[model samples]
Every structure is written in structure tokens, then in C-alpha cells.
Target: MKKKLLVFTGSPRPDSNSAILAREAARAAREAGASVEVINLSRLRLNPCRACDRCRDRGPGQCVQKDDMKKIYPRLKEAGAIILAHPVYWFTINAQTKLFLDRWYAFGGDEYQCFKNKKIGLILTYADQDVFTSGAVNALRAYQDIFNYLGAEISEMVYTTAAGPGRIKKNKPVLKEAYTLGKKLVS
Candidate 1:
């Protein structure tokens, strides 16, 4: 079967650097012959996980709260690969992205085991150009740890520095690298 990729973006700002990178990566994934779906978390009415543990009792992929995440659960399970695109916020992922990921706990327990060995990609944007000093480093590590714990493999991570909206477009190298990372995820 052909590979299916799910790209999720947590940037609330339209035309933000992270959004641009996510869109570019999706285009490249499509060009590489993978089915792609892009989900903008900011546009969705999603709620944070309540930690009720009802999902664990019900079965695999079950959640108690009813919200927009219902639409994402199926796609997430079906996806062969997943890409997360977000701007650095307070040294870590934005609230939207964190909320989305926290819900993945619904798929936990022995009854649910779909997330093993899935390919993962990350596109992070930060205003600080210095990788070490920027909050991006901590964000990247957090993502790496989460993906690793979920039994997923990190295919690639593309970090770009852009201070303003649409500013990343001027950096050809970063754009090219994002596209290449997308292609690599599928191929």
C-alpha cells in the first residue's frame, strides 16, 4: 500500500514561518507519491485531555471527551508517517500541539498498540538564530523524547530561524531542507 502522511501544524498565525514550512513539506510529500493530510490545530475546536482514563477501560483509540480530536484519531492511526510543525513557545511546543499529543494517551494500554515504529518528522521555527541559546533546543529535545517513548522513529528535524511572519521564505536553504525532509519521510 502507498504510504500516508499526516502533517499537523500548531501555528495560530496565518502565513507564519512554521505554517509555510508545513505546507511546503506537505507539497513535497505529495510529490514524492505519498498521500498527505494537513491539519491546522489552530483552526480546530479541540480540548485538552481530561485524564479520565476512560479510553484505557473502553479499548484502543477510545477517548471520553467528544471534540474535534475525534476527526484526528482515525487519520493518526492510519498514517504511515507523521509530521509536526510548530513555532517555539516558551522553550517548548505550543499549547495546541501539546494538547493534541496529550490526547494520544487514549491509544495507550495493552489493547492499543498502533503507534510502533511510525516515521516522525519535525519542523521547528524560532526567532533566535543561535541554536544553543534559543528555546528551540529544549523544544526539539522534548519532541524527541516523546516520539521515542511512543516507539516512533525520528526521520528528520528541520529547524529554521525566522523572527517575523513569512520571513522564512527568504531563506532558500531552510525551505529546500524542509522539502527534502518531507521527501525523505515518504521515500
Candidate 2:
């Protein structure tokens, strides 16, 4: 069976560096015979999690709020690999990505079973030269903790400094790295 990859683009801007890298990765994944879905969080109607612990009472993947996130829950469970491609904001993960991830609490009913043994990929870009200065380090650390807690494997991460809109396109190595990561995720 072909692997299915669910890739989330966390950038708010259309055609953003994050989106570009995600699309490149998705394209490579498709070429490598994986089924790939690329979803842009900024374009989705995802509401923040209410911290109401309703998912525990209702069951895993069941959240009270009716929104696109509900639609994503099954996809999350079905996907063999997941990738988050986003740009750092204010030295940390952007709001859009956080909102999406925060909703992952809905899977807590199963103790985050959906993430266990799953392959994970990251494509992070920032406006600053250094990862620490850009706050990408903080974002990576958070991902490490989350995936580690869930027993997922972080297979690849491609980060770079793209100081402005479309600047990431000039970074050939990062682009290739993203594509390579895609191929590896499905292999």
C-alpha cells in the first residue's frame, strides 16, 4: 500500500516560503508514489481548542466545536506521515500552526495514539539569519517534546533563513532538502 502524507502549511500568506517548500515536498512525495494532501491552515476555518476536556468525555477525535479541524482528525489518524511547513513569527511558531496543533488535544482520548510511530517532517523558515535569533529553535524544541511524548519519529527537518517574501526560493539546498525529506518520508 502506498503511504499517505498529510502536510500542513502554516503560513498565513499565499505563496509564502513555507507553502512553497511544502508544495515542493508534496510534489516529490507524489513522484515517489505516495498519496499526499497539502492543507494550508491559514485558509482553513480552524478554531482554537477550548481546553474544556470535552474530548475525554466525548471520545478520541471528538471535539465539541464543529469546524474544519473535526474533518482533519480522521486524516490525522489515517496518515502514515505528517509534515508541518511554516514560518516562525516573533521568534516562535506562528499562531496558525499553534492553533492547529493545540487542537491535537482532541486525540488525547487515545493518549495520542494516532501520533505513535508516525513519521514527522518539518520545513521551517524565518526572516532572521540565525535559528536562535529567529526563534526557530524554540519551535523545534516544542515539536521535539510533542512528538517525543507521542512516540512519533521526527524523520526530517529543513530550516533556513528566508529574509523576505519568496527569498526562500533562492536557497537551493533547503529546497532540495525538503524534496529529499518528502521522498524519505514515504520510503
Candidate 3:
């Protein structure tokens, strides 16, 4: 709890392009003297929000579903900065990433006070040539709406077009951007 940053990598593919961006960012955050944790969503057993309204009453840690999400509740509350790195699929955020976002409803019990002023970052990868065709815009819009509603500060949103796994490693400028974002998030 109370760590500098928590990066959730939502790609199902291990070491994907989005994951590379997350790694670069995390490395820079560490160099900036920030504590960082990079969590791969694929490695975690996460369930979609059932919308049972259990968390809406008590807020924060009150969730009915017993899953890995329980482990994230306090960390999400305590992290100074949060980064969501994921690949776009079907013209929107991937399933796993969307599920994670949905579960943030649990934190709504306190009117999302846990997210107020929290620094948030996003790194999105898509297969198409640009944001539109890649459908990265869709995912970006969703994140914008979600974070804005939560009263969080979106430090940065960096997206790239990487057609295959780890292709983002070739995009040096984006990588550097993510690094800069990491430092800025903590500062």
C-alpha cells in the first residue's frame, strides 16, 4: 500500500507490445526513485463484474466475488499512480482489461474518493495503421470517461500501432514517451 505506481498489463499475450511499453515505463519509474509493481492480468484469475451492487453500499474493499481482484483493492487504493497497458481488440478494450475496469465499481461506494487526484497512465497497442483504424480511439475514450468520472488525473495516454507481439519494441519514440510519462507520474 501507498506505493508509487501500479501498472496493470492487460494483454493476454505474454510480453506483448503493450507489455513492452509498460516495462519501459516501469523501469523509468524505478529510476525516478518510485516504487513500482507491474501486474500481468493474464497471470491473474479475474472475473467480470457481476453488477450485484454489493460494493456500492460499503464502498472500497466491499466486493462479493472472491477472486484475485481482492488482492488489487487495497493496492489500488494505496497506489499514487496507476497505469493500464493493454492491446485493443474488436475495436475496443480487451476483455480482461474491461473486466478490471468494470470492477472499479467496487470503489464507488465512497464516491470514488480513493481515486481522487490519483495519477493515471495508459498505454494502448493496436493492429491497424492508426488510432482510428486500430480502434485505439474507442479504448481511449472509454478510459477517458472512466477516469474522469472517478476524479483521477490522467497523466498521459500513449498509444501505438504494433501489428504483432513485441513489435512496439521497434518504436523507440513511443518507448521513450512511456519512460517520460513514468517519471512525470511520480513527480
Per-residue CA lDDT of model 2 for 107-157, tens digit only, reads 999899888899999999998889998899999999999899999999999
lDDT per residue as tens, model 3, 1-187? 3247999998888659999999899998899889999999988988889988988776677799989999999998889999999999899999989888888888877788989999999999888888998889988888889888999989888888888777777888999999998888887
Q: What is the C-alpha lDDT of each candidate?
A: 0.88, 0.92, 0.88
RMSD of each: 1.1, 0.8, 1.5
**Candidate 2: global Cα-lDDT?**
0.92
Per-model TM against the reference? 0.96, 0.98, 0.95
Off by over 4 Å in 3: 1-3
lDDT of 1 by residue, 75-157 (tens): 89999899999988887788889888888988986534677888999999988877767788988888888877888899999
Tell me the TM-score of model 1: 0.96
Best by TM-score: 2
Best by lDDT: 2
lDDT of 1 at 28: 96
